[model samples]
Target: MLVKLGVNSGFGAKSCIYMLASSAVLRRQQLVIRCLGVGGYSNHNINTNQKPMQGVGFSSGASLEADVENVLRAITPTLDPNRHKGQAGNIAVIGGCREYTGAPYFAAISALKIGADLSHVFCTRDAASVIKSYSPELIVHPILEESYSVRDEDKSFILEKVLGEVDKWMERFDCLVIGPGLGRDPFLLDCVSKIIKHARQSNVPIVIDGDGLFLITNCLDLVSGYHLAVLTPNVNEYKRLVQKVLSCEVNDEDAREQLLSLAKRIGGVTILRKGKADLISDGEIVESVSIYGSPRRCGGQGDILSGSVAVFLSWARQIVTDENLSISSRNPTMLGCIAGSTLMRKAASLAFENKKRSTLTTDIIECLGRSLQDICPVP
Candidate 1:
């Protein structure tokens, strides 16, 4: 029993921990660890991914021709009963304002729908109540102040309060989805800057989208050299980022090279350029997820991608660190982009199949679970 306890404990576990080949074996191992007072074993191991073990792989294509599905299946944690809340993931979105509540809602709720345990939304006072009304599952915090609401003298005090509020919960979050419906309020953006700095200090991973892209574009220093940061940019946003960082136009002639340059220029932060084919880069390799997708042009799909990536990215990081999964692509952000983009496209296709041309973002969000289960069914 003492021998069992020692191995079951965190002590001398990692070597064998990474070698648990199949989910069935992984599950049995997890249960034994939990029952034997080896709480740490269960952590960073199971309760990620979807349903049962597929014992199968996924499809793919990229600059490196990555086996996207294989990587997805590999890093995805097996769903185990021993895991508890927040172990799967606790994601926070720092976006939403009077003008946009749905973006944040879509991002936050999508995180939960994708299997994140706790999803929090921190938005402006005007947007908080509306977002809360959208769903009771979110832990909405009305803590951000817009430029129109604050006076010049109160800026400093308000900034501190804003940062303090976020700092209180900063370390608790595994990943932050910044700028879903986040408006371009100077005061609010400034406060967000402080929050981003604090998150970086805490070593928290961040997925930036929407207005977060706007802020990071204007101030490249915000995410420069921070490998944990991920930027998801649509067409217009990508143009702005490209122009600002590379000081050049979007060159399809050398699209992959340009993306690699852009990521390298940004000090190796990951970039997911949203297009017909989502291209992902971490300054090292350029990968693409060009699976079959819906032709429907929707407004909020990017928000879903951001939230999805945040959760998957956190999981990929955990699994990569803890389990020696078969991933040639070592960068967690890249793995996340591949998984998030692939899953989003797959869900979008399924939603379009059902909703046809009227496939809205919510429809796509609704398809997330079913789509994942279809690819990797729950046992």
Candidate 2:
């Protein structure tokens, strides 16, 4: 029975008064990556015999390794004295809740530390204070609400309110990082789904990670086929995504081919599969960054990667018309992933050198500037 309803339509299935929410199965379609690239970027497999980089060093001979450094230097904007605030980059992170405050803080602050002019975080009221306490440099909006604090009757109004708040600042952000420490709360996830929709409508690029991947795996419609989207998934997260989208186990022997297929299957959105060597694919080509990296398997590093990718991707997009980018048809999202992964690996290696086994995510964050400077110095 198709019941014609007005007020109940906007509210989801879980809304108060129990209204049926419409669900439509999105037909999977293959969409190509938008036409933006350097002329000659190549796909090269990781060289197992390649010696590890020493102390923020660049690979002297590996073509792919050298290509990564070149991409980083090319996309990173030069610091101009006349440039106004937010021109370098304005990154917004949409995550953080009662159970997770540090994740959002790490992602937001890392953006600023990596030279983004402004960094903002939208988190639950309970997390806003804690995140704010971590850094005065960040702009924290205590807007998102969790299930416990919100009554069902208020969910509709509250969801609209959340979207409105994000709408005000949506146009100002160069890029959005969608999941860091976001917990797996049903109501909060529902609100985030709406936010993702709004972001897509605005044509803004997003970096999905951590809990965002979880939200996306379940609702592939949220990000599937959005070329501006980039998903950074670790091992477990990648496994789930492959199973959900490709219906098969991860084939380590043909990891790049599988990643390529997975990206193509999802409509050309770039996927940065984090592992021993970060494998990046945008359905068109595959690139790997296996340079110097730390052996430490610490938490919060992925948050740092998500934030850094947001900045670099924004910068890459800003220079699409430059004639100097002749490496190949390297999409901006792919370039951002390569640069972010290389920088993260460099910083981690540096941190591990200093702190040894004591190296932490904070230590790695501290090394980002130095690592970048070593690769591409500010003249």
Candidate 3:
């Protein structure tokens, strides 16, 4: 006896098992099921051979790649003549402290170069002037304070003030890239925690990178269970995350499985494990973007990635319901990571083609528009 089951969409665990059993028993059975699309199961010659049946549905990997170019093109909004300012996108980067300011500047500016309508930076007082001087296009806020500058008696008042400052503009932002040059200052990290919580409440998407990963690694509750949150961790950061969450070292052979489990353990927050081929996972599915990038290994490229992810993530959210794409099973955060990583690599590759060993973060950022246009043209 052979049974056949046809499914239109992908099969769940229970449905998959049922189809397998039916195919084994009824050799000449055929069943048509309605899923997301039209796919059926058929078994021939069940009398002599009783073999386990194979189930076929859309593979998550296939779905991701199938729509990569389309997703990139769709999320990239067109430059309409009727559209005014801020319609393209408004991005905010939440990092930059005394020790480092270039990271936040790289992140905020990259958004604008990638065609975002507005880009803002929230940084410590010591870092604000430096970042502002780097680019007058960004709206820099010098509201954050380090503990060294605050009195013990004024900690509570100062904390509230910082929170208030961030809260004022939190809602207006489409997405926030947390941690670029964010140093691990106790006071500053504390304020960032509040800001993260507020962004959660406001339902704003967050892309965590650099020291932001450090902050979240220590305090998992900051982004845990938030579907809109994305974490971009380099080799060291990924190792730390694996150790912190899974209590084990990195397993190169099972990288994709580990990334999937890590995302699941973090309660569905998306993660982009940066490496030779960037691996992205959103708890349920794992995908890789292996487009060849620059070999220069510049310092601030991750900052560019975080900012680019923020813009793409914002754009992805805008097109979520535009079409019933086969890739809809994956979260938009995961899609954004895939598209952002691909674009960054293409830009880096293009920049490296010209600059070779001297390909800096700025050089790669300069190539973003051309790289994007190459992959997905406007007209």
The lDDT of each candidate is 0.80, 0.79, 0.78
lDDT of 1 by residue, 184-220 (tens): 9899999999899998877788999999999999999
Where is model 2 poorest over a 10-residue stretch in terms of lDDT?
Answer: 21-30
Q: Top TM-score: which candidate number?
A: 1
Screening candidate 1 with a backbone cut-off below 3 angstroms (N, C-alpha, C), the clashing residue pairs are 51-378, 52-377, 52-378, 52-379
What overall lDDT, based on C-alpha atoms, would model 2 receive against the true structure?
0.79
Worst 10 residues of 3 by lDDT: 1-10
Badly placed stretches (over 4 Å) of model 2 are 1-63
Cα deviation of 16, candidate 3, in Å: 25
Local error of candidate 3 at residue 347 (angstroms)? 0.4
Using lDDT as the measure, the top candidate is: 1
Put down candidate 2 lDDT per residue, 1-379, tens digits, no spaces.
1011122222222222111100000000001011222221111101121212222223445456676777788778767554556667789999999989988988998899889999999999999999999999999999999999999999999999999999998867778999998999998999899999988877678999999999999999998878779999999999999999999999999898899889878877889999998888877677788887999998999999999999998777655434445544336787788889988998999999999999999999999999999988876
TM-score per prediction, in order, is 0.85, 0.84, 0.83
Question: What does candidate 3 score on TM?
Answer: 0.83
Residue 113 lDDT in model 3?
85
Backbone clashes (count) for model 2: 8
* Displacement of the residue 21 alpha carbon in candidate 3, Å: 40
User: For each candidate, C-alpha RMSD in Å?
Assistant: 8.8, 13.4, 13.2
Cα error, residue 80 of model 1, in Å, equals 1.7
